[model samples]
Target: GGRTPRIFKIMIKRVVVINMEEINRFLNGRGSISSNILTGIMVLNILIHNKPSKEHIKVGRVFYTNQGSRSLSGGVEAWQGYFQSIRPTPRKLMINVDLHATAFYESDSLVQLVVKILNKRSVDDLRRIHDRDRTKLEKCLKNLKIFVTHRGE
Candidate 1:
């Protein structure tokens, strides 16, 4: 099992040091948004959208979930998720959300996953994977995030 994560609370005093004239100009569409303001808004979006959730797995701006998972191919499954962001318009700010989908490896032993991916009946029948199959497996597992529990996380 994985260990529980610790949460820390921090208190920050906000000090408004932005130029009102520039902000007004940007809001009125007379000028472009400043880098500092954009950066601050992006950071705020990250903090707000990343609230802890036991039902979803967040990866950057996308939230992947098993709620509507569907078997795609072999050991891979398609997961439905969403991407959320805060966008500022000339008149007001809006929260933009959209649906997203991606493939995820099944949560199981690597050997089992390999068996499924290769369409094998059992691990005992496998001696070694062919070079072509190895390449295919590498492509499928590339950049896949994994959680290790053998060492107790």
Candidate 2:
């Protein structure tokens, strides 16, 4: 057994057929639409609009990058991002875009991040970090994605 085929089975229990005219009328508030159809359309819109990008990190509807980073207290950096969504209106779909601000850890070593967060002069200051501060540091560093740079030795 070298490799196993990864396949999933999903079954749609019911199908409702509605004409474009009916959908248009419903969208215009002339008629009622099913919740399932509305949910499917919303999910489809999200998938089409949120395809992954190499340069941007997407979390839910917000997209951000390392560019234009502003340093904040405790080694946290504020990044400017944007939230985008497509909504169906009376006769057309409207794209809504809004500015968003998010906080990220500054690019630095673990020791440096700890030092900044604890307001310490150097690693030596961490030798006697209080339990409360240690818990704070744990929460801050938890689930943080770190990249290692290797230099030829």
Candidate 3:
């Protein structure tokens, strides 16, 4: 009755690699910290693949949109091109909105909509969102953290 197939997980170390002083200097001398983090990650990604390393073929990025239900629908066809440009399965990619900043004429519907999305799929992590857009999202994360702690995970 105990016929569970073994699942293998190979862990590779991920690091920023740059010294804190260099990072701080680069970031402080340039633009925002968030922008710097993105740039550094991109550089690491480039470094990770130098030759014909066929291990990882595609990169999965979760794009964030601050706009909720009020975005202009024009030229949305261009998004299809962006989706087609990515090698990974489109299902693996996700876009998350700032739930706190999302405004609707009906507040109840907004909350319900957010909860529905969370139930339908894994909610994207909120650590990278702007500080102003974090209250409701942070509250959700804190509550989930508590629940997970209680569940002994």
Candidate 4:
């Protein structure tokens, strides 16, 4: 008898944020404080992956994909390229904002938290739980100080 291939389901969650302040800072040649923070989150994800192998974990891909017209276009293009490279057959995308992080700390803080979560898990294991119940997740995340806007399903 032939053995069945052990198929693995990976769910990759990604968050993208666009902050005006960060864009202004970058354009003015000033240190992009917000951008730096966002970068930190991306780095954190990589760090999370370092410990566990990719086969056993799920990851959330988060970043700021829109800032302004030009910036947003660039970000979207880059992300589209990246998504295609990954080749997610039925990609599920969600948008969320950390009320506290973005409102108080900075947009980057929220981005960082997302990256941290993504890095620890494998794409297959990363399930999009938000789709099941947007309002419920919204309420849960809101209470936890994270606010999200669902853009795409």
The TM-score measured for candidate 2 stands at 0.63
Q: Residues 11-81, candidate 2: write the lDDT tens digits.
A: 98756543556556767888777765476567656665655344588776778878888999999999888
Model 3 poorest 10 in a row by lDDT: 74-83
lDDT of each: 0.76, 0.78, 0.35, 0.36
Clashing pairs in 2: none
Give the number of the best model, judged by lDDT: 2
lDDT: worst 10-residue window of model 1:
15-24
Per-residue alpha-carbon lDDT of candidate 4 for residues 1-153, written as tens digits (9 for 90 to 100): 999999999998766554545544554566544655455445544555453343321223322222221312101111210111111122221222221101111233444443333332433443553454445334434644456656573
lDDT for 98 (candidate 1): 90
Using TM-score as the measure, which candidate wins?
A: 2
Off by over 4 Å in 2: 1-44, 51-53, 148-153
Global fold similarity of model 4 (TM-score) = 0.19
RMSD of 2: 4.8
Candidate 2: count of backbone clashes, pairs at least 3 residues apart or interchain: 0
The TM-score values for the models, in the order shown, are 0.62, 0.63, 0.21, 0.19
| TM value for model 3 | 0.21
Lowest summed lDDT across 10 adjacent residues in model 2 is found at 14-23
Model 3 clash tally? Answer: 0
Ranking by lDDT: 2, 1, 4, 3
RMSD of each: 5.4, 4.8, 19.7, 22.7
Can you write out model 1's per-residue Cα lDDT over 85-140, one digit (the tens) per residue? 87777856677889989988888888888888888889985687688888887887
